[model samples]
Target: MALPTSPPEPARLAGDNWLANCAEWPDLVRQAWRVEALGTIVTGTRWLAAEAPLVVVLAAMKRIPHAELGPVLADPTVEKGWWLVPLDAADHLSDIRQLRVRPPGWPLRCPPTGWQLCGRFWLQPPDGSGLVTAPPLLGAALGPGGPRLPAEAFG
Candidate 1:
């Protein structure tokens, strides 16, 4: 799904579907970063904060063509931060399930750090409505090497 170049309206997703407000997009991105950082630290991996990958989330009901997503995933313009992947409903659910499972040597559950950890994928809209101009869907963080989808986030 090709999102509009400009931000969309708030009422666009007002139904019972999960939606992330445009205002909170930054926070969501930050949370994803924190999750990545925490994961690396806990696992004893090298902490390369500046070299963190971008998070890509597939938020739409239909899966985005790999041709389209591939380019975005491989895009070199995005140095650091998370980006939406735009997957279909089925794929989104699958991805979420994969993310929820804690990896070996990782914490069983995310700590109460207030920041939504890896397994915690859903983001509540500020107004408790549908998504807004910026919808927080399944995304992956991009770093120097490649895209890092939220995984082993809790641990």
Candidate 2:
């Protein structure tokens, strides 16, 4: 699919949100897979690219207490969050290829063997299949920006 020329609108989910407004393309979603974990929380930084807009989805895993503030103190709970960032084929060519060439040690229990380049996002399925570059769509709906996690994701 052609790179979205203009930014799309954003979509909101329970633990995820799209930074850009993108259409809910069934085909793309069908091709997409959920990323359950990462090598480190810092890996989320790699998802951001200047070439194209990326959607970063994050989910909270567990909660912890703030040492500075006691449990009885004001809002002192902290949550461990995971993130999923989508990359565009044209924009993140180098980064995507590099990951495939030399898969990094992400803090995942079962690291991804490879990635699937769907319409606009780089997907990593639970299956161990290697890299897959999707064929371009003639008239695929390229939505706005991309997905993002909630505020808690950063903390």
Candidate 3:
């Protein structure tokens, strides 16, 4: 005789769709599971993020007015942080030598929304509303990185 199968649990069902901001969300969750470190994807869109030392990241976070902050991913192991910003961030932050504005189409590995812990986790997770850091505010907070230096400046 064939046995009946039970449906996936309620919490299991809700968990899967909470961060369904993008179309690939379900697949991304599966990918997160495959990674096993509880990480999700920060991809698509015309956005670019600024990757900087943890200190700088925190500094900017503090400077942003009010209590309103946006999604952020942090990696303690590397002492680095990434902030989700608009597409124009590249030109706005061009002077920042201490940071790197990730090129668009870069698939950043971040923790799924909510309180997830791993080597690389979200400092500020997405709020399920697809909100991102305001570019002008972020730019103002970090100020300018000063002009880019010549290669020999490092040597």
Candidate 4:
């Protein structure tokens, strides 16, 4: 199965307006992006790479406010997760061992906002507001092992 370098001008999505305008996601509306050999050329924002478990740990932790949650993509095959953070997030996440701030112009496999295409799924779908995980908080929560959640975690 050939994944699209771009999905067919993705059908009207919930955050299309913001993605198209605010986020400046290139070719989001005009191009025909489909699951092919490659995915989308994510622009205007940056990404953080980590294991799926750690990403899940961060999402489930009560300490990390729900509002802080942003767009997260999960690759079941690799059990890896991709987080859409502010473009400058690298400065904050670079120090963390469990996470790697993707370099500029990174190509992430973003299938869409609301569906799991192929093995990629959105753990936290984009909402158009463009608010993503707070890097500082993410850094503080991460440890050599993984997220240091409070006693009552994964809620």
Q: What is the C-alpha RMSD of each candidate to the true structure, in Å?
A: 15.5, 19.3, 11.4, 6.7
Model 4: per-residue Cα lDDT over 1-155, one tens digit each:
42323322443364444443433455653242343322364554534433335455444443455677766667777767866677778777776676777776655655555445567766666676666777765665564443455666767
For residues 1-155, could you state the per-residue lDDT of candidate 2 as single tens digits? 22222212221121022211121332233233243221111112223211111211111111111111100100112211122223343333343311221123232121112321222222222121111222121001121232333478799
lDDT of 2: 0.21
lDDT of 1 by residue, 1-155 (tens): 11122112442233111222222243453354444422122211211011123233323212332323311111123422222222222233234322321222332111112223333321221122321211123222111233343467757
Point out the worst 10-residue segment of candidate 3 by lDDT. Answer: 1-10
| lDDT values for all models | 0.25, 0.21, 0.63, 0.56
Which parts of model 1 are misplaced by more than 4 Å?
A: 1-5, 10-17, 20-78, 83-155
The residue ranges of model 4 lying beyond 4 angstroms of the native Cα positions read: 1-12, 20-25, 28-39, 43-63, 144-155
Ten-residue region with minimum lDDT total, candidate 1: 43-52
- Candidate 3 scores a C-alpha RMSD against the true structure in Å of 11.4
Candidates' TM-scores? 0.17, 0.18, 0.68, 0.65
Instruction: Order candidates by TM-score, high to low.
Output: 3, 4, 2, 1
Report the Cα lDDT for candidate 4: 0.56
Residue 85 of model 2, lDDT score: 26
Best by TM-score: 3
> 1 or 3: which has the higher TM-score?
3
* Candidate of highest lDDT: 3
